[model samples]
Target: MQAKPLTIITQNEKMRNIFSGIDHIVASDSSILLIGETGVGKELFAEYIHRTSPRQMQPFIKVGLSALPAELLESELFGHEKGAFTSAGNEKKGLFELADGGSIFLDDIDDFPYQLQSKLLRVLESRELMRIGGQVSIPINVRLITASKNNLHDLVEKGIFRADLYYRINVVPVDIPPLRDRSEDIPLLAEYYLKKFAPEKEIKIEKEALRKLILYQWPGNVRELRNVVQRISLFASNEIKVEDLPSEIRNDHPMQSLTKACHRCLTNEEMTFEEVVACLEKNLIQQSLKETNGNKTQAAKLLKMNFSTFRDKLKKYLME
Candidate 1:
């Protein structure tokens, strides 16, 4: 049977370039490693590779390695014969066997147990496996696609991941850009999901609401956006207003916004304590002035500083 075409709902140029690269090599069987933060849709990218590959008609199995228990991971990936363990009641094919002549996506490969790395490497190298308690070695023909939220190279450097296996899987690496880096796509995605979840309603996002969506950093990426849209769909009126957005998006927490404003000061290692303090103070003064409509005395009072002290600060920070 023919596999359904993979649909990646992205208008971002970074994503487009990534997909273009994937298309160029989908015909090859090289191991593809997808690197992205959690909920950045690594699994979707894996499926895209599989569905567009020469083995599209073949089975495409996906396994979240982090979700599986450490004790059962080996057995699950390599299969097990009946009586292999106390809980083993029937012989079964491992994911690799089931994905013969196909692709198997291993999400969170960084969480794969260290001791089992060698066994996994052996399978990838030899294209064969020996099920637990089975004598015969089963030859397999499967394409391996793995994903990691952490840089596998960093894990290897720390000795948590095997270097050999890291080299094996790092053949074709693809780095997915986070949503915050591609704000242009926010409106398109929000509109698409709104239509999907509220097909019966003429739901639309107000300009202010859409602006907030683009401004707020989506730490959870596309998944979080989808959830937010789905939740609002149930309660939103025909026009989704800024007030309809979750508080986090509509109004960032004061501290969060402050931290963002002072990000450079906080992260720059060369900045001294006094410099950082000055940076924070300047930002606070600017914010206070904006809030008080340029009323220096009111700004000073709001910041709990004497007018004289606030005047000196304004001059010091070049606000005067």
Candidate 2:
């Protein structure tokens, strides 16, 4: 049973070794940075850390740093004092104070601007927060767990982020690999979602459908797979059939958009400019003629070429 949202799988020795050090990672009195791609569940992993830690009973404050306007993010994180801004009527406690004695998950941490890095550095260093425009610093003991879907090294090289701050937070780095790299787990994930989603809609997933699902690359990762399974379970029958797949996946989607769309790619690579043009002209003429029910004049108009020119191109391609 997966007790946490970020189901930490110790499937391999590598993962087992990594997870073995998880206690040290979470128990450290310093900031922990979790890095992974979008949709790979970085926030979920952060939640796991909070849930397993001693501060599990305390509120787990979630701060979406990227969602916040950069101008006001610092104020939101560190709190604001009276007259700090046009709307600053009263001194407000930031996430740090609100999450005192608990864990704070800072999602999309890379979006944090360098301008506020020093302010954040102070908070991390002092274990306290000072509201904007406030004279007195408030002591707040909050464990910080941050996640980013970006390459911090690239940001550092570009000089957009502070190197000192990056090193401070990256004391124990947890990098989550994408779903594609772990295709071996696709069947497992599919079955899990199938069991979860099937009962609500009275449906059963077909083994063949599961096979197809496992084969395709889930670009959107687990989230995308969950969506697919959800839809299938909702619309499909007690015994799911291959034909019951969503129309997009059921048919040859790439070619059916246009009959000649597939052919375009095939012969384009081998044909010279004139040959390619001739092929395209033939295709257009044939398509227009078919749509117009073999009416030459209508086909010519559709092709936007005169009857003679259209006929000439058609014959040229046919003979070639």
Candidate 3:
């Protein structure tokens, strides 16, 4: 099956480069280890890789290790035969078995039990598993993708994670930068979530509101941002203003400073229309460049301009 278009909207140079690298890795059958903070969209990245791989038509199963109790996680991952345990009245298939010929994503792999890591490593190495209380070794052809909020390397050093298992899964490591590190993508992500949650409404975010969003440090990352947008959109009018934002975001000091600047600009009558527009454009471009750490490509993307057009504007403003 043809893969659907990617919904991972990002223009940050680092993320773009990571995606490009992932494109090459997806063609091959290799274990992928995605490392990132919680709510940084590691699971989404795993799904994207699976969707783009040859296993697009096959089943894609996701199991969160942290969510499952240790007592049931083993059976949930490797399945169980009839009478394997008191609750096992019927034979059951595991996530790996269900994901045969496709991909299986194990989220929060760092939280996976230490004892079970060896079994998981064995599966990765042999591509086979034996259901609990069963004699047959069932072969599987599922691609393995594991995600961790904590660094597996450090966990291995601390003896929390199995070193061998870590090596096995770390075949292709993908690190997702936190939202705070890639603030340049904030506007785009906020807009994307806004459209997703309120598709029926043609809502616009005021400049001050957007500045507040961009300035606030998103502790919960993309997930929190999505929730914030959803909440604000629900109560907002045709336009979302600073006051419509959550209290934590609305009261940010940086946002207050930006609002003051905007007020000053509006009150200034000495500045010509062309001069005011030019000044605002220059400031926006500079801000974009600053957020992207001087990466022109990403700065242009943040400004919603073509690379050539952005360069021309830079030259016109004597910014280059």
Candidate 4:
């Protein structure tokens, strides 16, 4: 069977720009480092890269490095010979060997064991690996794609990650924006998932419910939105009403509201104080727009700002 092409639904300008850049380098053998929060679909991005690459026909292996126990991680990645360890009865091919002439996506690479990083680096550098307790060297050709939930540079500085290994994997870093950063895509994604989960029924989300989805911060990003849509699709009628939404989303706590408003200030370590203020201002303007249903004049009035100033702010923040 032919492999299906990746369809990442996004109308956001930033995301479009990111994809544009990615398209230019899909054929290159350079390592790609995907940096994003948990549940932001880094694995999806990795698959997209591999699917579009020249090695698409070859095996594409994905491994969540963080999910593996440290003690067994080495054996899993580099494989083992028979009698390599007490439990090793049969020789096995490592993920690298299995992904030879293709791609290997190592998610949560920051969590990869420090001791094993050098071995990984050596394989990537030499294009060869030796099975545990085996004398023969096995050559492999695989494109490396790594994803990290945290900044690998910070980990390197903290002595938790190897700097040399970091440089080797940091050939082309791609930062995926969180769902909140690309709120414009929420409605599109929601509709996409609605049709996906309930193709038989032509269900639709009510305007108010969609507004709540767009306004509420998605801490889990796109993954959270998919789950929400899947849950509601199961019980939704012709139209999904506000009451049909989850209670937490319908009745956001005041503290959660505050956090949402100041999310950039709190979570982003790279943002300066001024940037945080600008973020807050942009968020407030966005909230007003959502509340007034995209009526610029009404949104301006709701924020108690002069129409010209509001318009300028909207243009300044590129919301216009």
Provide the clashing-pair count of each candidate structure.
0, 0, 0, 0
lDDT of 2 by residue, 1-320 (tens): 22344555435454456556676666665678888767766777788888777777787999888899988887888889889899998878888899999989889889998889888988888887788888888998888898988778778989988898888888878887666557676667666777777755545557876555555544466677678777777776576676766554443322233356337844667778877766666676666665444666555755568777877876776731
Residues 216-284, candidate 4: write the lDDT tens digits. 666667898899999999998789988999875785532355447667666888989898889888888
What is the TM-score of each predicted model, taking all chains together?
A: 0.81, 0.72, 0.78, 0.79
Q: Output the TM-score of candidate 2.
A: 0.72
State which candidate, 1 or 4, has the greater TM-score.
1
lDDT of each: 0.88, 0.73, 0.86, 0.87
lDDT of 1 by residue, 1-320 (tens): 66888667777888999999999999999999999977789999999999989899999999999899999998889999999999999998899999999999999999999999999999999999999899999999999999998889988989999999999999999999878779888898898898989999979888878888998767678999999999999998799998888887887633456556677778888889999899889988886665445767556755779887999998898889
Report the Cα lDDT for candidate 3.
0.86
- Cα lDDT tens digits, model 3, 1-320, are 48676687887899999999999989899899999877899989999999999999889999989999999999999999999989999999999999999999999999999989889988888999999989999999999999998778889999999999999989999999989779999999988988888888978988988988888767678988989999888887689998888786776453344344355456679999877777667776776665555767656755668888999989999989
lDDT of 4 at 275: 89
Candidate 1 C-alpha error for residue 144, in Å: 0.7
Candidate 3, which segments miss by more than 4 Å at Cα? 253-320
Give candidate 1's error at residue 270 in angstroms. 25
Give the TM-score comparing model 1 with the true structure, all chains together: 0.81
Every model: Cα RMSD to truth? 10.4, 12.1, 12.6, 10.7
Off by over 4 Å in 2: 1-17, 198-202, 243-320
